[model samples]
Target: MSEPNEALRRLLRESGWTLSQCARAVNRVGAEDGTPLRYDASGVHHWLGGTIPRGQVPRFIVEAFSRRLSRTVTCAEAGFEPQSGQPSQQTDIVDELIELGRYDMDPSRRGVLGATLFSVTLTVPDWPNVAGRLVAVESGRAHRIGVREVDAVRAMTEELSRLDDQFGGRHARPMAAAFLVNTVGSHLRADASEPVRKSLFSATADLLYLTGFMAVDEGLHGAAQQYYLKALEYAGAAEDHLTYCTTLRGMSLQAVDLGHAKRAERLADAAAAAAPAAGPRMRAFLAGQQAHSYAATGSKHQALTYIREAEVAMEKAEARAKAFGSYAPSSLAYHVSQVKYALGDKVGAIESLKESDRLRHSHYRRSSVRYNSLLAERQFELGHLEEACSTWERVLDDYPLVSSGSADRKIQHMKSLLRPHLRNPTAAHVYQRAQDQAESA
Candidate 1:
């Protein structure tokens, strides 16, 4: 027989919820995750008495407590073992990636995955831990792959990235997930010459990174981190420093966006440390993120120093025709705006954001909506009601064309911010338009 779940009992007591209330909270979380459960007081009683809840019930319980306590609660902390068949730290990266991608591809499973809590305490493998660690698959069904397969994967990744930029991840992520499951998974298992194998891994790593970026765009932070970890694993296996560092930087961006400044700073610093030999553009990219994160953490001197470094590297980078990833002048400007805002220079941040919008590429429709909405919010914060309304109108112009969770969140914020100012004609008009867009959406 299982031992009594003393830890869970303690947490339950701390929550001050009766057994029935606890069961109802779990049921509510399950319902939100699209897995309706009729759990009752008996279920909580059994769990408290050492009975293990089956399937995803433990996760639901953990989430319920987390919501009540307003903090993360791990399975171990809740006196539950890790779920059977769930990916663990010891799971094979390739197999785990395939499973994650397949789940992402299935519409029915997507809701549950989307409801996953973004753990601030997620363990990320360092460069030394994962570097060159991938072992060859010894399956009898493993086939041979070549340069052709590698090129095809890279081309497909590029096309999906373009689609993500033009529309949003909501429209492109499913296709990417399908490709990862049906095509890239097989390629990873296939045998290849040493050089071809490394190239294939590198290409696959890039695809994983893009898919993770799309997951972030969809507000699937937990899923995005899983995809990014796989990308780092693949990049490390391939000895691809660029993708490894880039994936870390992407995670930092996600953390900062979610208001985890210290975690973001640590990740940004790790990205910079991992890519010791990065070029000028890559340096600019990494330093720009570091600046924003540091500023967010209230490190004024460090933030200014890193931003200066980014500017110098960007100046040198512009002399070359080739770009490193998508870290253009526009992206740099956005980082500058973030840093300025973090340091309390709201006006400077606005001006920098305007510069970013001006320099932004035409294909970045999703970014336009997200950033313009941010600009409008800042404008409203500064009492520029009419100007804020004007900017929000611009956002609505492109809002219908984009399908991004981040953009949707910004529009929601616009409505809340305009509520008190509804007496103003422009604010009332913008709020109505946003309402119409939300209903239509």
Candidate 2:
């Protein structure tokens, strides 16, 4: 009645894993996702013999192979049919965004969404392909909207961003997702004047970008990419070059954080190319990211050139009275640190990171935890055990206040790095304190 899964068998052969091992890996992924399964060798055998695994098992299987092979493994590649209810390429952007938001807001679905694998081979639509391509969503009961609605969306986005900065995405993202599903979706489907409609699209794009950024802070990389793609669609539909380029740049940040250097370089360059008329501050923001991506790709000369451009742009830009989440001197410093580290200048990286921390704003508590932990790791690398311990203590101080996946990872890494040095009194004390914090968390 069914054809054998030759594609999956091929991937299984490439993975060099026994049937039991494959099943165990899927089960492990399920457990991590809080959807524990009892898959076994027989399950794998049946899957390979043409029996389709039901209810998210296929996703788990693909993720397991992706992990083993260190690359993405899609369902089609594994000979599985597309799951029902999953969005297809032909789905409208507004509908896709609403679906993503709804899933993100639901507690039962959130775990599965969180476990979605970040695909390195994801196809990114170019500016030319997406620009001004708004699909009209006709509704029979469309309500009239105006400038007030646009302003309200903008104000809410700003407030959510502030909360994310003060606490972390883990605390703010749910509220943002709920807002997107309950309020923004209806607004998108409402009738409006041409100018007001475009303005609404631009404002909503900004909110989507911020929501994606918060998803990244929580380590939901794949879900973040989905949010970013929707943001790009909306920004392009609005013909808003600034937000379009900004969303691309945000996607680049996500790729770079996940260690996809070449992809990051491509995205950063695309962002720069898309916004030729960007202001000094935006240029600095874009160029700073370009510098890090270039350095990560081993293009030292290009990296230095971009970093210099960013520095010049920063100097030319006027100071903003309220630059909450805007790119500033500290962000540039962090980029410089990343470039220096990538180029084998560890001491230079440390100095730049210290400068970044000093220049950082007080509201960015999550950033403080992440960057300070990075500083401590560099210090440990340079054999400054006591100094590293002291830096880690600072991280612990802020760790309790921020609920960020990135910060959690940094603390976990700190513990791992201090293991060999635990014989030292300072290292042991810091390790114990970190252990206690982690347990409480």
Candidate 3:
């Protein structure tokens, strides 16, 4: 292997990932099409030094290198021959879709795909701030779909929604995000008329937004920010105000998560202004997000005021029209309750949480809220260490087999915060047990 390629290979191994793991990332494309590519360790070793593999396999090679490195990598970075110099190739977009699919699913893979020699040839500009204009849309027209047949982007969006609800964001986000970058992105690149393309654009925007959502769930806040921005641009292009509003709300939520209270508030306010026609549910969700921002800033009065507004919005949403399918109106109670807790209104927070839990469907995947963990925190705060420990243990057992990033971190954070409160003998015993489980995991 040449120097650059050898260095690349060594880096991959040192990262605690196997060659097969890298190969599997690329195989995401092959698995979808039933024509998996095979790469041996030796093959990887050779490719690193500047040997380009034959056929569409190069795309996978780039993807694998990127995932392990946690950065965008190109075929050239891995010492592969430039994509343009390939001897022969198929123009079918499906093959390209496969390549994209592999890249988007994993951040490391995305870095590689982004750096691939052939990327510039793809010619789609960096995803815009919001989708372009959406003047006319011919929904369900075969002429617009052309030879490159598809199941319609909306179908894919619905699939993502179902997965999110059933499996939780942690379990299902990566694949959903990949589907957008690969399949949906492919359709957007196809040669369709303006109207047909507008519909396609809107669908693509939704997928991108969902992809960002998944990224946030996975603890990739920076990547999630970029995806949300791209989705916003696409949404603007689609001339879909609702989608744009939703994207803005997503951005605000992310800001809140990162502790940027003021920015979150501004974004939420902007969303509320832009989405006048948005259903009550959408409006309520935005308001609740704003409430979170206020609470994070320690403005108890403002937070309470926004919470009331959110409640009003939710009631109006439930009574006015129920077609706001993307987000549930009733979730306001849950969010407001959380803000209250953050502001030290423990009693109010617990009450709101109970209401939210009742209204929340089992499929809503509210694992991030960790109400039980919060309950434990409240118990500890009230001088009930034994009850807190018992509560935490129950939560640990509830999802024993699951290894969700959000859940695990929440547990760790809880344990860290309660360390100082372990003076009670029974509490100390429980804390020691929790500590053992955490360390073993």
Q: lDDT per residue, candidate 1, 1-441, as tens digits?
A: 888999999999999999999999899777644478998999899999999898778988987888788677878999998654443443566777788887789998776566565555677899998888766665445588899999999989989888888788897899999999999888877877889888988888999999999999887877898899889989999888999999999999998987778889999999999999988989999999999999999999999999999999998885532222558899999999999999999999999999999999878899999998999989988989999899999999998998888888788888989998889888999999999887887
Off by over 4 Å in 2: 1-5, 9-73, 81-90, 140-142, 319-325
Indicate the worst ten consecutive residues by lDDT in candidate 2: 318-327
Q: Candidate 1 lDDT (Cα, whole model)?
A: 0.86
Q: What is the TM-score of each candidate against the true structure?
A: 0.85, 0.86, 0.64
* lDDT (10s digit) by residue, model 3, range 120-197: 111112224344544232233323353233445677677776665445466566677567655665565555866666
Give the per-residue lDDT of model 2 (tens digit) for 1-441.
878999999999999999999999899767644478998899999999999998888888887898788777888999997655543454666677778887788888887567665665667788788788767876545589999999999999989888888788887898889999899889888888888888988888899999999988887877888888888888888898888888889988888877778889999999999989988888998999999999999999999999999999999987652333368899999999999999999999999999999999889898899999999999989998999899999999989998888888788889899898889999999999989977887
Pairs in clash, predicted candidate 2: none
- Candidate scoring better on TM-score of 1 and 3: 1
Judged by whole-model lDDT over C-alpha atoms, candidate 2 comes out at: 0.86
Instruction: Using lDDT, rank the candidates from best to worst.
Output: 1, 2, 3
The CA lDDT at 147 in model 1 is 98
